[model samples]
Target chain A: MNKIEVCFSPELIHLHELQGKIVVVVDIFRATTTMVAALANGIEEISTFADLEECRRMKSQGFLIGGERNGQTVSGFDLGNSPVAFIKNEYSGQKLAMTTTNGTLAISKSANADEILIGAFPNLSATIAYIQKHRKDVLIHCAGWKGRFNLEDSLYAGALVKSLESSHEADEDGALAMKSLFEKEGHQLKGYLGQASHAKRLQNHGIEADIDFCLTLDLYDIVGKVENEKVKAVIKP
Target chain B: MNKIEVCFSPELIHLHELQGKIVVVVDIFRATTTMVAALANGIEEISTFADLEECRRMKSQGFLIGGERNGQTVSGFDLGNSPVAFIKNEYSGQKLAMTTTNGTLAISKSANADEILIGAFPNLSATIAYIQKHRKDVLIHCAGWKGRFNLEDSLYAGALVKSLESSHEADEDGALAMKSLFEKEGHQLKGYLGQASHAKRLQNHGIEADIDFCLTLDLYDIVGKVENEKVKAVIKP
Candidate 1:
């Protein structure tokens, strides 16, 4: 079996080190969560851009622009970084040029990875299934807040390790810590993360709904994989 | 009440933003723990430097040269990065120049902070006392492993918040998460961090004794303060 590793916040900074590994990009607070929901709810291919201008240029190419800034929708973009906005019927069979605060930046950093798959609670099972089938060393890349570690992202990483712990070995200390934290607190989401800084920030924003949406398990059977700077669903064999 | 923030890691990247905060540097695995233990056991002052050559130069200036690498004592040094080494009559009345994987880097980055104090479980109470007396906005900086977010450091940050919850306000999600984690598992050091990647790495290296030593509480009362590219103890009133 290929080794599966988890990269916490600091490891994510040197993301190029995982160039040879199959990568799973996770930003559960919004980016990956939105992507998982979009794909699961039947939206077609999503292209990502690091710069707003690049995404804007794609708008002229008939792509729907999607992204956000500091937790709010960017003006003139067709879709925001909200799961609700991404799950609409009108977005069906469409191309989405997406960007966000952290997740897209992570995807950009891991451009050298042999494969990049979006992982979130909603698509947890499908993501694990893909990892098992590939049997390649996996690098779980958490999109930390502003290139720093955040609570929600690390917890999601721990949650993933809990799902695939039987066959994977965590190479870094961060991976081991999150995995243990998960093993202890997997059953109690709110209680485990109630005093977390991000949870408080979310509560302050009155966006309790997003937090609930981000934590839903295995809601998406589809896998979001990156190809040519866009994330397209893999049609399961 | 000055704002109290938590820096998730000790990477140089965040140094630009932490320029004005009062930083509490935590490296429980060894560095800060060692510093606290050294001072509590009657070592006069601990001086820190990033480069070994500089430490040597400082030693020529009648200071003790001490440091470590990959959790082992540096070859030809006066001492290693363990608190156990500093607890002796040999270190009294002598200055010390030291470097380590994480703590030194954090102290260097914190050069711009209004003030910097070394913190760890070994001197948790004194650290809190220093911060309370200083009455400044504090930033708990976790000197993570090799520029990444290490769990032990975050846990230490949480431990601080857990101890001082009533007197502090967590301004960000990162702070709240750490406080929550600490509240949940701070007391049981081994139980809480036994599976951490670094701890496991140490166990693999037959250095398990250091983990227990690093986690001991109130072992020292010395406070480390930063001054012109080095850290030395501030004489308490």
Candidate 2:
């Protein structure tokens, strides 16, 4: 059986062997969810930057700039980190550049993986189907809130592990712990994850709708593949 | 109310602020469990060394040296990382120097905390009592297997958080996740943790008895406090 492991945060990524694994990078509160939403809505591609200034620089190169810091849109950016903003397909056919506190950093740090996939609740089924077809060792990387563990991303990781249970073995304790968490509380995703620190942080900023949207399951049948520092929606096999 | 946070691994310790907190370092599958057992049963003091050679070198100074690597005792050490060896109090009044794959390194990394306490199931009540008396922000540092997240240690952390919930707030997602884990599976610890990777590793080495012993709750009323690199049993206030 193939193995399924979880790296709780980007900081803990080094402890996991990524050389031959399919790394599913997830930032459930918004970043990865937004990427999936944007891609599914017909955005040309999504380029991620770890720095807000770098992401803004992409605006001059004809990319729509989206940046957030501590749950708010950066001044002068065209969009914030919200999946709802991308769902209308208003920015359809646009090339987007985005930066966030945690998500982009997670994708950047997962450069060593054999394959990198952007993961979120919206693309959950697509992700599971893709992994099942590939049959490689899988590592779910949660972009925790600023390198600290968060509930939503880890819960999503658990959701993925639970979904892939038939083909993949929960390889490590982190994966097993998350699988249990999802099994127990996943049905009440919104109410349960609302108690999360990041969720509360976003709620304080009046973004409760974004949290609910991010928790929506299988909203898009899209698989995002990270290549050349950009995440592009790929056709599922 | 004071905050109770769980740091899932020693590698993630840097993300937490430890300056004014009471840090509980745990390695449930034997290291911290052994320390609690040794200290509770009248071993005078236990000094933890991260290096096996350094721990072995303490033998010349009248210290009983114990060391383990990958679930087995070092060939020349006086004891292995098993609590059962210390339960008889054979090393009463003798100081011990020990090393292990993950435990000692966790203790060493936690030096920045205001106070460090060795924690395990056997001393669970004692640790809870100590934290109640101190009423400080608590950080449960789980010494995961070789800097990776382990179920046993994280479960112990959850148990600590659950016990302290009346007096302390679950401060982070990690803490809340662990607290939920303990509440859900804490009652059947042995059976639940028996499926843990570390527990399976020890069982493979023919140490099933030690796994059972380590999972025993409140077997000791001793609180091992880290002071100047030596863990001395302290009279609970």
Interface RMSD of each: 3.7, 1.1
Worst 10 contiguous positions by lDDT, candidate 1 chain B: B10-19
How well does candidate 2 score on lDDT at residue B130? 90
TM-score for every candidate vs. truth?
Answer: 0.88, 0.97
Q: Candidate 1: deviation at residue A91, Å? A: 2.7
What pairs collide in candidate 2? none
* lDDT (Cα) of model 1: 0.74
Least accurate 10 contiguous residues by lDDT in model 1 chain A: A7-16
Q: Write the per-residue lDDT of candidate 2 for residues B136-221, one digit (tens) a residue.
A: 99999999987889999999989999999899999589998998888888889999888899888888999999999999999888
Q: Residue B124 of candidate 2: its Cα lDDT?
A: 92
Interface RMSD of 2: 1.1
**Model 1 spans with C-alpha error above 4 angstroms:** A1-4, A9-11, A69-76, A86-88, A183-208, B12-20, B69-75, B200-206, B228-230, B235-237
Fnat for each predicted structure, in order: 0.40, 0.70
